[model samples]
Target: MPKILPLFAKALTDSWRSTLGWAVGLTAACMLYLPLYPSIGGSAQMQDLINALPPEMTKALNYDQIASGPGYTQATMFGLLGFLLMSMASIGWGAAAVAGDEESGLLELTLAHSVTRAQVVLERALAMVVRIAFLSVLVFLVVLGLNGPSQLGIDVGHLTGAVLLFAALALFSGTAALFAGALTGRKMYAVAAGAAVAVLGYVFNAVGRQSPDVEWLLNLSPYHWAYGNSPVANGADWGAVAGLFGISAAFIVLGSLALRQRDVGV
Candidate 1:
């Protein structure tokens, strides 16, 4: 313990305000959507509205389960809206971790201290892990609080599974951004890479839902891997969670290598 990871504390301190903003946003999302379940998920008209939509549209959006409590919560917080929001936040943090600092010349200052390049990347990645884990816990608690009032019908076990899957999914994008940032030393590349994964993975999952012919896309889509077995209801496929964490670990390793190979670009 040689007082390593000076960057870890610095990163969290630097971004506390942004992290708080994310917290507010996440909690607000939980309150807004979960409360509406009693009105929307419980309504016959809501079902009518869903039925009125094209089957293809419904399938793509996972609207088939909007009437149920667990399904409603999944479609809202853990699946669609919150999913995109968390992914966006993850990408922002991940991009800023290395590429943003490099561009700002702050990385040079950090490097002037006694630290290896891998340590810089590792500390930043650890910061990301902490933040995402916090948000995931935030989601778990907020959703749990709403479960009784909003009638979400989420059990502790299944809810835990949902949040775990959601965390892994968001981290998947974040690590992609980290890898891209380290590889190119450009924040734009990091954002693009992360966005590509979120958007394309979502599309692949949607398409795979359309028919069995393309269902193989489900296997490759991170979105599907998280939600494919209906984690909210089925209590998560542990194998998928392990796969996501494994892949994220690989990205971190690759990012360290990439950063080490290149000039700091400061």
Candidate 2:
């Protein structure tokens, strides 16, 4: 007979509602935004209006290319709303994976079973990966479904690259929270860590766009690694994608080790 990962199953079962809510919310956001793109984006007057906005404002919002199909999709859907939704979902799951369970005394109970501490941590992380992957695929399908109607001329290859990069970026933030939670066993700490990574990465990328002296800062920002070159219009930056995934994998390994070495519910 084959063995099942009980902790992974439990994690999914316990958090299915939150996962469903995030999926539904992401779908709704994608549907609403993509449908509106044609009406607003297809208008020359609207392009002029966007062009008239302050350069700093456009750069900050990654809105410099809202006049075209791929650009519109990137600026509104992937760069703005989709980014916000995925980040929130990933961060919440990461925090809850370890720190929330520990805080609630559930970690202790789960560990009292036959499972090793490594299994608990790794399974929880795996569950998070699965949930994030599901949401990413949902985003890809929703966007692809609306591509023609919305006049988004993004090639399938570029679209796939954008989706993959976006998912990796979100996972990186989640793993930051996961690492913090495993190290500290505190939910608040995990939340703070994840939020810090997301917010700082975004700010650095935005600011770097405005100043050449600070442009190098973008190298340190995950937001830049994901969307710096406008993956929706361009294509995947394979190096950046690799960096994001590598960093995330490193965090998971460190977090798992930390969890194994520490006492639960302490």
Candidate 3:
């Protein structure tokens, strides 16, 4: 086993509540995608709900790309609901992974071993990946079981893409945690910073959706790219996905470099 696995295991074990909480929350939110099932397509009540939603709200929900309803229910889920789940899961996991350790003074002892700081960060990142994957699979299974064959296939595909998208998001959030761990050495501050990034990203996406003139600003926020280019609506913009990964990798490198220079327990 990797030397870092123990650290990651301990981290996850120590903060099982956050992991479990996000799992439950994301699963519940994903159920909101059930409306995309083909069985519901013909329902008058569901159609009315789609129609009644405001134009700006629908756009924020990415209703234009739905394969059924006025648009796909899964698409609406991706635009807003999916992001909310991801932000909570990824940010919370990131916090527990790094800053949480540092704040507790465990990082100093953990780093005293032969293990490198890079290994610590990399392993924590891996733990986040595993946790998010489990939640994603649970959500996909529930979505598949709830929807019919035709709509089920589409919903599953969209949800799969969203899982990958949020995995990338978790990586990005981990970088922020790494930065915070190396910067203030405070877990709470790290979590707050990550949450700030999420909120700002959400606000930017909301404003950009309301006005085309502000749309260019959307490019600045990672959520905008993921939310706007959802596979359900925009059919998976590989370019944007690549860009997100690239930015995430850059941040990861930045945090690693910062860790190398800083003294632990600062």
Q: Write the per-residue lDDT of candidate 1 for residues 63-123, one digit (tens) a residue.
A: 7878888988887778888898899999999999999889888888777888889988999
RMSD of each: 1.3, 1.2, 3.3
Instruction: Give candidate 3's error at residue 142 in angstroms.
Output: 2.5
Q: Model 3: residues >4 Å from true position, as ranges? A: 1-4, 12-17, 32-54, 61-71, 149-159
- Model 3 pairs in collision: 66-71, 66-72
At residue 248, candidate 1 shows an lDDT of 90
Candidate with better lDDT, 2 vs 3: 2
Residues 1-266 of candidate 3: C-alpha lDDT, one tens digit per residue: 45547867876676678778877877676565554455554456756776888878767666545546323544644456766677677777777666777778888898998778877877676667677667667766755565564354454455567656666655566567656755666778778877777777777777787887998768767777765665553355666668777876666566666667778886
**lDDT (C-alpha, whole model) for all candidates:** 0.89, 0.90, 0.66
* Backbone Cα, N, C clashes tallied per candidate: 0, 0, 2
